[model samples]
Target chain A: MTTDTIVTAAMLAIGDELLSGRTKDKNIGHLADLLTISGIDLKEVRIVADDEEAIVAALNGLRGQYDYVFTSGGIGPTHDDITADAVSRAFGVECIHDPDAMTLLGDMYARRNMDFTEARRRMARMPNGSTHIPNAVSTAPGFVIGNVHVMAGVPQVFQAMLEAVLPTLKTGATVLSRSVQSPFGEGDIGGPLGDVQKAHPQTSIGSYPKFDGTSFSTELVIRARDETILAAAEADVRAMLEGIAASRRT
Target chain B: MTTDTIVTAAMLAIGDELLSGRTKDKNIGHLADLLTISGIDLKEVRIVADDEEAIVAALNGLRGQYDYVFTSGGIGPTHDDITADAVSRAFGVECIHDPDAMTLLGDMYARRNMDFTEARRRMARMPNGSTHIPNAVSTAPGFVIGNVHVMAGVPQVFQAMLEAVLPTLKTGATVLSRSVQSPFGEGDIGGPLGDVQKAHPQTSIGSYPKFDGTSFSTELVIRARDETILAAAEADVRAMLEGIAASRRT
Candidate 1:
């Protein structure tokens, strides 16, 4: 894949539970890893409350900016499960109970001898002109409206839905990263490190510092689509750290 | 505090680690809980990468909209720790090494026989005309420039710095929430729940559903600054669920 062939995606985490500090979102990281591995650069993430206006605004902002916008939560069989409706409003489409979703859910409930209640029927609703994203774990399948892929809030079900959706999407070149840990502290090597970063215009370099009880250490990470440039930048970073550490010893 | 005197805050979590999915953010939830207790509405959250332009844009956007803007991560002694510089640029100020910060770090390092090197001295830097937000976990303090409160990335240090900063800020009436769990599924009671929500427009009602192996249950939460309204809304929600459950039984 060419260096310029980069794909990007954004995520909108829809839940009052997340914003209320009741639920620590595990889906963002999980989705980020999946997107990165599949060569799609995960650009931005926004977490909004379960309010329709908030979800609609966030969805519009993200779907316009990124190739794919994934939404998690608020698609359950409840009053607060308004993600599908909000997404529909964002895309200027009517939310309808898709017949396919109804059949799938109806069959699942019948097999289990469970009541196909009205609330359960709500799960069959999706925005008009959209298609279902299969749910391997749960019968309540998620749907895709425009560029947005609406998925379950439950981690297991979300992961399963993502696995199903990924195969059909277009993927770009893999963005790889290399990390070099330096025994020397960040302050000890910041100048030379910045110089190395300035020299490698194509690669993005990051310095993460940790202060143990006695001393400071740093992990220098370099990311790029091209392995050759990335390796070259990583070498420069390593040399810069070594020179700093050597000068400090003397 | 009057009901009209509600305050709002926004958070910006900076770092490539968070964007790359290498680091799971613990600060957003921590700050959300603190802000909620202090009656500050956390209006929005944005997670941006370690790019200076991204940080500056987010800072400008958030600080302009909210009463308070809090930043987490990227304020360390490293090349990648460019939050202070970005914030300075965002506010059109110079980043300077404050005298108090120099003294604090100098004394701390001196006691431990560690070199107060140039890179280490970088920790003393803050935006011009800014006051240091003391860090109890580490001597390297965070700072506040304009309405933005820049805090450390480490969870322990971030919490300590926030504790130090919160006491100095103006706080509002404590917003409270009451939750009632109903054995009835969301689908069973969504219509009535929506009606109750419309009737109690003052209180924000949320319906969260959980599907156990056998059936679905819902947690209906009502939040408001006024206890009377919140309690009244909670009662309406409870009655709505009870009526639905009773109807289903018959």
Candidate 2:
């Protein structure tokens, strides 16, 4: 859905594996970065158990509230796979064995010289009327129903599907950023840094402090819609850091 | 916060560093697991820019919707940090230097025999009338206000603070789970799998398919409050996989 203003999107990552710490979610961050660059506001994110109600609830909450809803996980041939069914329930569609998806599965398996078992065929199940979103790195494809974009949870597959899907997404004005780093500790730099931020009200400047055991470093990042304002803030931050470092040395 | 039925929580991860990919967010998954195990349902999570409005908007949303709100990050002695101010605004409370937090921070720095900068002293700020949540990790303690529990974003500190704060919460029945793995792809099992699920209404069965270069390996997880029901569902899953694999071998 194309929007003149910011397009908000929600993310639903489903799996017990993630909560069990067996898997760290890489897809959300990738989407956050990708959507940020594309100018889509990622408004809300939820991670739920593989329970059908949980999936459906998350889907219902996300679907129409934002321009797009992205769901990852539970679209596989194994027993825990329930996302397609949940989506079917959420959208009130039949969990049909789509012929198009089946053909793709059949072609891929035949090319690989493998027997297409019923378990293998499960990958073709989609909510009726949903369009397939191709996976560049894997054979099993992702799909879209209404605003909910359902994809695999596997990092490689998720990323490939994201690349495939992003090109077609109706985007917004991109959020751009720049940064300046300092060797000084944030404690010695916070107030002056706050002043720098207060002075540049249009451009948002954020301070991040890091410790490397023996020494400290802080990064001041300036972000805005306007490139010129962002650049000006970056220079101001650099000047502050240099002045502080020089004063500290003396 | 104690409720007879349930305690819901939301996680707020603040850091421009995380958004920039300079630092990986390690606390989100940890907090999710800990809350799940404690029988506290983690309903929502947010990662925000270090801007005050962003933090305030997220804080207000979680505080209003959930039984308890847990925030991590931006409570440190740094200029980029503004969660305390944001939270104060959300709560409509004056954020004067909190006496107890000040005492703890001062003592911690005094023990190290180091000079505490104005930024270091900034860690003393807390919303008016909040209760101090003990920090056994580094001693720059967190605080609790109403249903909101503000903790450090560092994994170790955040975890330690969560453990300390969890006892103050009212818990619900613990969630239990079990898993079964199969060699066949998901398609071979969908039809019968749906039937088996229809038979066992109490047990929630989740199917996850893994794309293993040449073949698909799927894992069926059966979850329920009743172990007997879960085991029965597991037995049915085993039989389903056997039927699929046998057919594949032919």
User: Model 1 chain A, poorest ten-residue lDDT window?
Assistant: A208-217
Clash pairs detected, candidate 1: A119-B187, A187-B119
Per-model C-alpha lDDT, please?
0.85, 0.78
What lDDT tens digits, residue by residue, belong to model 2 across residues A84-189?
9999999998998889999998998899787687756778888999999998766778899998899999877888899888988887767678877777767768
Interface DockQ per candidate: 0.55, 0.37
- The sequence of per-residue lDDT tens digits that candidate 1 reaches over residues A8-125 is 7888888877776766788999998888889888888888888899999888877988899998998987667889899999988899999999999999989988778787889999
Cα error, candidate 1, residue A191 (Å):
2.7
Q: Could you give candidate 1's per-residue lDDT for residues B1-250 as a string of tens digits?
A: 4655888788999987887887788898999888888878887888888889989987887898889999998887767788989999999999999899999999998998978987788899889999889887778999988788999887777888999998888877777999898887676677778789889888888877665654657777788888998989988888877787687789
Local accuracy of candidate 2 as per-residue lDDT tens digits, B181-219 = 767556666667878888898766766667776666667
Which predicted model would earn the best DockQ? Answer: 1
Give residue A211's error in model 2 in angstroms.
4.0
* Candidate 1 error regions (>4 Å): A1-3, A211-215, A239-250, B1-3, B211-217, B235-250
